[model samples]
Target: MRTVLHGRPLAARPRRQLRDHGDVHQDRLAATFADRCEPYRGYGAGAFTILRKIRQGTPWKEAAGSAFNGQGSCGNGAAMRIAPLGAYFADDPKTVTTQAIRASEVTHQHPEGVMGGLAVAHAAAVAAKARLTGTPPPDLLGSVLDHLEDSFVRKGIEKARRIQTAEEAAYVLGNGSRVTAQDTVPFTLWVAARHLGDYRAAITTCVQAGGDVDTTAAIVGGIIATPPREWRDEREPLPDWVRR
Candidate 1:
């Protein structure tokens, strides 16, 4: 398990950075993530920046996701920043994937990065809806793969072929601390896949296998918070402080 590290670049983005120059349409929701999110389980730093821009009235396209620095999909910022999308669409995966990609585009411009967020958020949304509906979707992993539009995230999953445990997958897939969707998304997917239904266990396990705490937590939280069975659970709320 990757233990937590202090002063690591995997730091959560501050809410204060929600600049007025960012986006304009969904700026409110994004800003709420900035204001209320915990960086990890909440909106991440990069994510906060994009959200604030959105709230301050930036279009989702220009806030950050647009061909950033002309590199396109350069950072794990996309995956790191996309948790709330899953929560909002907790009842609908198709909606969750659609919105998450839209949200991820605020900064994570690369198709791979966008795909990473899409896969994770969609998985979480499906998990939540399944538990609520008692239908429990088909193979959790296959479902995620089916929805992802990026080929890179899919390639990373292929890289995970030899990985046995989440830890090994981390060694091969990375935890997104590197800020590249390629580096971070695959590992989160592996961990989430391993613990498809057990949300609590999933979060703790990922925390222990730490790399990017906030991003990993957010990814796993999206999954656990919305699983396929409505198991009895009681813990910290996601805080309605968001979307203010």
Candidate 2:
């Protein structure tokens, strides 16, 4: 949320400015952002690996390139962190998708990684727009799918639409157990679409799915939380460090 708010000043050329903001925001988040708060102990391999490289003086490009045997990481890390940017450009899916690419390229260089970022950003944009227009949940996933170009991600989303429940979505669309974008974004979108108006339910689905729970939950929470909706207090708040 702070990222989007920080972006408000750069609204004049958000497409270009926000892209740089993403890189700066990431460094800040991994550095000072964590230090100012109480120590956080939960582990996420993608985050730990990136932070380790950054601490060792590796450039973002080199650090990212070193992942997955130089093919670069195809993890959902890009998608997991991109939703707020999407909401910032909620009025334009094209802009959302384009800017998402810029953000993803900083750390996620692979096609699947970029695609996952685009899918989440596009979905978040659509969801934000839906909140403004009172668009229903049923239309959300389909609307996002229309703007996506990757066949593998598209196929997963297409299958997501056929799924009748969150459990089914995890089963058929995957739950990020593979740690790849292809296995994560589609199911996150499915839960976001299914529970667009119910933030609690969306997070619940992620938690219940049982694999890479944090990333899946983060992706779902980011997209589903974008649009104005009733946020039940019953849902546990994210750690102060996360919000900070």
Candidate 3:
């Protein structure tokens, strides 16, 4: 969120609670990937199905949405579920962020939404780098305002910093009830930054913010799960397989 909007460091970096590292985050991501499919509303669920099949080593192309013509586009959905990729890679954020967009193209074709994915992925990737490097996270709003393209999502991200609390950001910007990047991504980024060091807190705060609970939580979880410094070493390990 900050990377796209502000492009600087976080204001008051949140305290991190190291726990459930390793495979837990990745497995949860796979589950979220599947959960988003249950409703399967036209375009919402198609990307994951394609993603799973593709990851299985299939050279697949074509998605289930209409945003970037036939090329597909950006959507908050891509931004939301990409944390596991960031964590899995842990060091190479660009690769993970790229993968996040690829995940988005399977469904969203909208440029704004695609940009949302990129922003979220970049945050996650950066978070991973911070976790490994022991560097404190930057001011999130500044980061987003600086990196992300000027769009509805970008505007909303700027608003997030002013809103003080996470609840306020979600209320004013959006909690993703509409599912567009404009409606959801900014708030998700806010939540991620607000809880940068604490994975569980970040996710719970998303739930408190309401609207698109899982999606918002997932986005926040992805960002906070990996924060600046080697916090993971202090946390509990995640399960190899998620109940999802």
Candidate 4:
């Protein structure tokens, strides 16, 4: 919401949003994410560091590049929030890919982390196009994989293609247990692919898989589902800034 309202380039919006509102925990839902949980009160560790630097007026590239002893972070943090960006560029796959990388670079400079965001963004873009056509993507994961370069994240997604069940996917591909993009994006994409038309089912599968449930559910939900009204009613209203 801040991104759209700021009227800035997509690549520039995340840094400003983080600087101004990164630590606000507005969700009223019952979740155990540390950032959203009491006492922690901010983004995950990787994002927190980047946000701190951004708040200090550090450039996005420098802030991101400085993390984890200069290797940057490969955490799923970048991927978790990128589905909307993919949908925004739904008609342009190339832009979706490029912008996703730029967006991730604000807080995740590691190639795996950037690739995770790329994959999820592309998945959301494909799903958005599918929604417009009123036909589900015949090979959603494959479509996302086509846009990705070689990486463990890509390999994990390939492994996702061979899995038949969510439980099996969570077991083999991991259920965001490691909090890395390599561990999380593949399984979330698998769920999104299998339950693209069923928002409730997609979220249920994420919760049942259990590890990093909030992030996994957020990624899948951003791709293929909007929460039902009943579910929405249980959560806090969107902030005024988001509404604007």
Instruction: Identify the candidate with maximal TM-score.
Output: 4
RMSD of each: 7.0, 6.0, 9.8, 7.6
Poorest lDDT segment (10 consecutive residues) of candidate 2: 2-11
RMSD of 4: 7.6
Q: Give the TM-score of candidate 3.
A: 0.63
| Residue 42 lDDT, candidate 4, scale 0-100 | 34
In terms of lDDT, model 2 sits at 0.70
Residue 172 lDDT in model 2?
90
Comparing 1 and 4 by TM-score, which wins? Answer: 4
| TM-score, per-candidate, Cα-based | 0.66, 0.75, 0.63, 0.83
Candidate 1 global TM-score:
0.66
What C-alpha lDDT do the candidate models reach, one value each? Answer: 0.60, 0.70, 0.58, 0.75
List candidate 1 segments past 4 Å from native. 1-60, 63-68, 72-74, 80-84, 87-94, 135-138, 226-240
Residue 183 alpha-carbon offset, candidate 3, angstroms = 1.2
Quote the positional error of residue 102 for candidate 3 in Å.
Answer: 3.5
Candidate 2 per-residue lDDT, tens place, 1-244, comes to 2212211212222233454464334444334322322214443465457656766667667776777788887887678778777888988777777777776766677788888888998888888777888866467778878888856778898888788987788889899999889999999998888788887678778889988777787788778774333443334454443443
Query: Model 1 scores what on Cα lDDT?
Result: 0.60
Candidate with maximal lDDT: 4
Sort all candidates by TM-score, best to worst: 4, 2, 1, 3
